[model samples]
Target: KLLSVGALTLDTILRVETLPVHQGKFIASDGLQIASGMATSAACAAHRLGAEVSLWASAGDDAVADQL
Candidate 1:
């Protein structure tokens, strides 16, 4: 089994045709939101590779943590 210990963070990804050069309103064609961080990501990868994985991430007791 793999034990991953680190921070677990919530991430947001947006798909856009192009990056804006100037500050302006923008719209996303698609997007994904997920919980990811160095160790958490590693744990996920290990699990996908058929290994038993566990994650030990530090998180605050709040909405963000609940989402994780």
Candidate 2:
């Protein structure tokens, strides 16, 4: 068994057409949101190795926490 400990974060990634030279409102052509952390990665690896894995991260009560 493995106990993984680390942070859980909500990450946002945005893709734009071009770099901006000045301050202006821009549109994102694409975007992605992912919940990831070091502990999660380790837990996955352990599971792949046939080890029982557990995540011991704190996810406060909230909508985003549910996603995590």
Candidate 3:
């Protein structure tokens, strides 16, 4: 099975020590969300399932596109 379609996004996630309490404050970011593209996720899953997969995605820059 091969998946070849949909949008790709670079997810930016922040892990705050707690919910924002003030206008100006700082929190510790434990991790960042990334590559949460639905289709791309699926394609990667398919590949892991032992299927040849190719992802077809639309991105701003080719460099970013290549990451997909």
Candidate 4:
């Protein structure tokens, strides 16, 4: 088993053709929402490698936390 305890965050990853270099807005071709943060990601990786993993982290009592 693998146990991890630390921060858990929601990652908003974007894929774009190029990053903006000026003071202007840009749009992404694609985007992804993923469960992230050090311990959280490690636990996921361990689970993928066939380990029984557990992650201990705190989340807020809001819609965002609900998504996590």
Highest TM-score scorer: 4
Worst 10 residues of 4 by lDDT: 18-27
- Give the lDDT of residue 1 in candidate 4: 86
Sort by TM-score, best first: what order? 4, 1, 2, 3
Q: Write the per-residue lDDT of candidate 1 for residues 1-68, one digit (tens) a residue.
A: 88999989999999999999999999999999898999999999999999998899887899988888
Number of clashing pairs per prediction, in order? 0, 0, 0, 0
TM-score, one value per model? 0.85, 0.69, 0.65, 0.87
Arranged by lDDT, best first: 1, 4, 2, 3
Error of 3 at 48 (Å): 1.8
Q: lDDT for model 1, on a 0 to 1 scale? A: 0.92
The collision pairs in model 1 are none
Cand. 2 Cα-lDDT? 0.86
List lDDT for all candidates, in order: 0.92, 0.86, 0.77, 0.91
Q: Candidate 1 vs candidate 4: which has greater TM-score?
A: 4
Which segments of model 2 are wrong by more than 4 Å? 45-51
What would you estimate as the lDDT of candidate 4?
A: 0.91
lDDT per residue for candidate 4 within 1-68, as digits (tens), equals: 87899998999999979877887777889999998999998998899999999889998899889999
Candidate 3 regions exceeding 4 Å error are: 20-26, 62-68
Candidate with better TM-score, 3 vs 4: 4
